[model samples]
Target: MKIKVVFLLVVELLVVIVVVVVVVVVVVVITVAIAVAVVGVVAVVIAVCVLRVNFVIVKVELVIVVVVVVVVVVVVVVVVVLVLVLVVVVLVLVVLVREVTAEVGYSTGSSVLELVFVIVVVVVVLVVVVFTISFVVRLLVVAAVVVVVVVVVVVVVVVVVVVVVVKVVVAMMVVVVLAIVVVTIVVIVKVFVVIVVVLLVVIEGEQVVVVVIVAVVAMAVVVLLLVVVVVVVVVVVVVVVVVVVVVVVVAVVVTAVLVAVVIVGLVVPPAEQNF
Candidate 1:
């Protein structure tokens, strides 16, 4: 009986030790997990701050690019307007020459209808170019929006495009009436910066599991950003190409007509010689 009682005592002591060891192990695990979570949160905060700084830098560079583009477009529009004016003036001179020569028994007038048509073409080209510039400016804004959303986690996004020099059309109208004088395109794409701070908290969950959750979330965000950025870049390129092609077509048509006018003005007079 004594031997059996001693055996029972030993067994009870072993059970207490085992329970104490398990409690200690659980406490240590919890402490380590808490520490890891704190560190992870700190790292996340630091990353967010760094990302914001980089975003600002990118924005400044984009603004500079926008300024350069605006200047180039303005210069191009001015040149086109000048060329169209020259064509009109030349057409007028030719018409006057035809009228005077006709009074002295010259042949039929060369191109009264042609002059009218050329004016119409010039006007159409001007409108299209003006609108094209506007479209590009708008696209730039959209790209910026995409950039912001991809870079940071956007809870809500509101994109707005404000036209600084929207009335290039009005300027073209003035050109039709008076002359091609107003050539100024001021485009300022103002993007309202909204940064939403969402602190990921795993309430009532194991710290290690929470860590895994954070990691998964971060990975997902990164993957999403990459996909969105690629899509945005592709779209921007295609749209830009389309608009550029239209601009090129306008240029080609205008040049071809100008060359024809030069040929007619030169060739017809010398060939006939009666006028």
Candidate 2:
């Protein structure tokens, strides 16, 4: 009995150690991924705002998207592989414990085995749930960012083309009309931002409050810029300022949420099961 108890304790200790190691590995991986993502976002911002190279902008954006997809896939794969490894380790431990107990004339090791199995299953379930939620939250944020970027880009391009055509074919009055259109688009963007935030909050609840705050701050900045644009009636200035502010805010907000999800997901409560 003493030998069996000792072996059971060792098995439990090994399981705990494995879990801790896995968590640490996951946290490290997420931290590195976040760093890479932030770097990519910064590069994109520089390409758009500072360098102002059109091709560079397209390249950086593509790189960011590809990097994000790869990182997510790699993280999920790492997690699943590690979980499988843990399961295998636990199975081996279970078998060893059963053999040891049986050889010692204590054949009823099923209860202990059941308890360990339950713990492993519970751990796996919690991990899957956490990652799934995190992934969904991230997908929503990325979608919102993409929507904002695409709309802004399409509108800006259309407005620029119209302004050029109007400059050649119409009077200065047409330019004024285009200015009004730009301001109207700015307002529309603000409203869209609010709607997206509300939808995200409703869908994800607690973890998404960070995104709401970010959207509100972005709107406030845009509003201030709008006042300036209205006073100066400068289309070029408004376009550049709005683009920079929106892109930066989106990047920062997404990065913040990624970190939040990582922390939230890793925090699994200790499971206790009485068999």
Candidate 3:
């Protein structure tokens, strides 16, 4: 009789231990899935949006995305199979607990209904905890994805602004060099005109000097406008990049802290229950 009671106690402990293990395993699997999904989505975005920037980086990100997706799918399928097996195992254990409790109750003349109720309550609480943890994991995944997207968008915007700034600088440099060339030509024409007007007394030389002066003035105005435009663009781009980087950094830090908190919650509870 004592042996049977000890056996029943052992069985009950096993049931609780098994349920806790299953819960931990399921949580772990789901966490991995969340990580993979978040990372894969980020990689895909980087690969697609910034493909022209760096071929090697894009290719590497794409490969990572593919590997992450494959790993996630395999993990999910395995978790599903594991859950099914756990359900079967739990049911079998429940039946065994019931039979053992019945035999013990019949011999010891004690009610078995209380033990059954406790088992049901434990199972229900575990289910609720699992669902809660799952919900938190989902939220974490969404937060991580949002953080990544913001960072990526900021980076892309920075790249675009830098590209535009570079092009503007190149265009401005070309305009400045062209203006200097035009000024040099205007000076040469003036000297030639003086020589020609004095030596040859040609009427067309004065008109040619006037035309060259007007062309030089026009080039100077165009160069001034380009410089002003370039300066404004550079200032605006610098300000925007600074603001965006700050915002992205803050968002990433907050998201990371939240993820860490949720991970601790998941890990600590299972460990405490197991002990």
Best by TM-score: 2
> Tens digit of lDDT per residue, candidate 2, span 4-102?
444544454354345434433443343334334334533343333322223454654555455545655665566566556656665665676566556
For all candidates in order, the CA lDDT equals 0.37, 0.45, 0.44
lDDT of 3: 0.44
Tens-place lDDT per residue, model 3, 1-275, is 44554455445545544544444444334334433443443344433433423345445444544543464455446545655665566566667666877876622211232343344334433543444344334434433443344323434433332333233333333333333333333333433333333333334445767666655665566456545544554454455445444544454454445444434544476456432
Report the C-alpha lDDT of model 1 over 1-275, residue by residue, as the tens digit: 33333333233223323322332232223223322322332233223333443457466445534543454455445545544554465455445545544544422222432343355446545554655466445545543554454222211111111121223323433333221111000000000000011112323334555655565575466446534543553454345334433443443354445444434544566566453
Clashes of each: 0, 0, 0
How well does candidate 2 score on lDDT at residue 263?
Answer: 37
Report the CA-based lDDT of candidate 2 relative to the real structure: 0.45
Candidate 1 vs candidate 2: the lDDT winner is: 2
Tell me the TM-score of each prediction against the true structure.
0.27, 0.40, 0.34
